[model samples]
Target: MIQTHRKKAGFQHAGLLLMLLPGVVFVFIFSYIPLYGILLAFKNYNYSMGIWGSPWAGLEHFRTFLTNPDFFRLMRNTLLLNIYSLLFYFPMPIVLAILLYEVRGRFFKRFVQTVSYVPHFLSTVAIVTLMGVLLSPESGIVNLILKSTGAEPIYFMAKPEWFRTLYIGSTIWQNAGFSAIIYLAALSSIDTEQYDAAYIDGASRLQRIRYISLPGIGPTIIIMLLLRLGDLLELGFEKAFLMQNPLTYDTSDVVSTYVYRVGLMGGEFSYATAVGIFNMVLSLILIGIFNQISRKASSVSLW
Candidate 1:
């Protein structure tokens, strides 16, 4: 009987593994198989020779990238943009989730949520074009309003100072609603009894949110934060590329954009790969550091 039970459990576990097989195979094919291309980072990457046949360059590409004059500027722009995203864009979702959770009218809440989610579905080109139309110096409503007030028409897209602001703002507008869905799911998992008990004790709404809702979703928040840290340097290449112009390059040129121009356009495959590898390594280190810190401080981490 004991042997029969063990065999049954083993079959159940095997079934679960079988169900997971497709995803494992998919990831292996798409993600792990491509890892061999990392060789490009350390190779001269002659087009005629291909990746494996190319001669090893022995850190030549890495050294060149590090010594490049735009190195500091690229690093600065990427880090600052990501930092701004972490500060501003990250919290917007949480705030929206909290607000949505507080709303009593189900119809109104659903309507608002649907409206907020519309921006996320828009293509990068559409979003950038919309921005252009809204901020155009001549016909844009923003410029027209400024003109009406006897103020100068500001060319927002052409200004370096406005690039980061516009990028971050658009990111929040596009993603916050969709990102909030995770927090809402987390909030829903909290025991409703705690909320009821707080209400019975005459606790205010803010106090309940502070003591109950916040604590309930703390683990989810920490996990999401750790995951976000893993992609600290992985900005969306499409949006940045579309939104930027020569005048805004100082603030808008990120590592990814630079990699595209150098690797794909300029045909410097090895050097671009080296730069990308550096970005990936830095991101890994950051996530590892934050994971440890979060584990120690909050007993929550991705690992």
Candidate 2:
């Protein structure tokens, strides 16, 4: 009997490996192979002198990036943007998922989920373009509404102060529904028995949710938060670049945009690579620190 059980376990393990094969291959091809390009960070790369053939300059590239006039501005903008997002945008999906979980009518819940997730499917370019049109000072709906209220129309896209607010608000709208999907799945996995017990104890609906549902998905929430911290410096350039002009540069210019401007557009490959590597390393360290804290505080982590 033991021998038969062992054989069954061996077959299961083989089946699991088969299922994992494609994902492993993808990671190897896309993630691992590209790590070799980190060498460019230490070199003065040129077209003729490939990554390996390029002359090593030690920390010169890093020094140049750090000492550049806009270094502090770039760092501040990146951190502030992410910090604002964390404060306002991060908790939105969790709250939304919780609200969604409490929705009893199956048809209504599904309809709401469908509508919410639709924005996530829209391309970044389309979303930004739509925002631009809606907020345009001349012909936009927002300006029209302002005029109706007897207020002067503001050009939202042109102002430096409005950039972060617009960016974070758009992010919350676009991704919150999609982000809630995972938490909703997590909510479904919770044992119904605990909820029933809470109900029996004269617990109110909100109390039951507080004690049972929230704790059930607490680990998943913590894990996502840790992952967010890891990418704090690596905000997407597409929306910001598209929305921004010289007028909004003070607030909108971030590390990713700076990299694009200096590296790809300016043809400073080595400097760009170095800046990118630095941002990546900082993210790794922040992720590690946050993960450790989560493990200690809540016994939930990404390790």
Best by TM-score: 1
Q: Where does candidate 1 have its weakest 10-residue lDDT segment?
A: 227-236
Q: Local distance difference test, per candidate?
A: 0.94, 0.92
Best by lDDT: 1
Q: Which stretches of candidate 1 lie over 4 Å from their true place?
A: 1-19
Model 1 lDDT per residue over 96-215, tens place: 999999999999999999999999999989999999999999999999999999999999999999999999999999989999999999999999999999999999999999999989
CA-RMSD of model 2: 2.6
TM-score of 1: 0.94
Q: Model 1: which residue pairs collide?
A: none
lDDT of 2: 0.92
User: In model 2, what is the error at residue 131, expressed in angstroms?
Assistant: 0.2
- Model 2: per-residue lDDT, tens digit, 49-150? 788888998999999999999999999999999999999988988889999988899999999999999999999999999999999999999999999999
lDDT of 2 at 74: 93
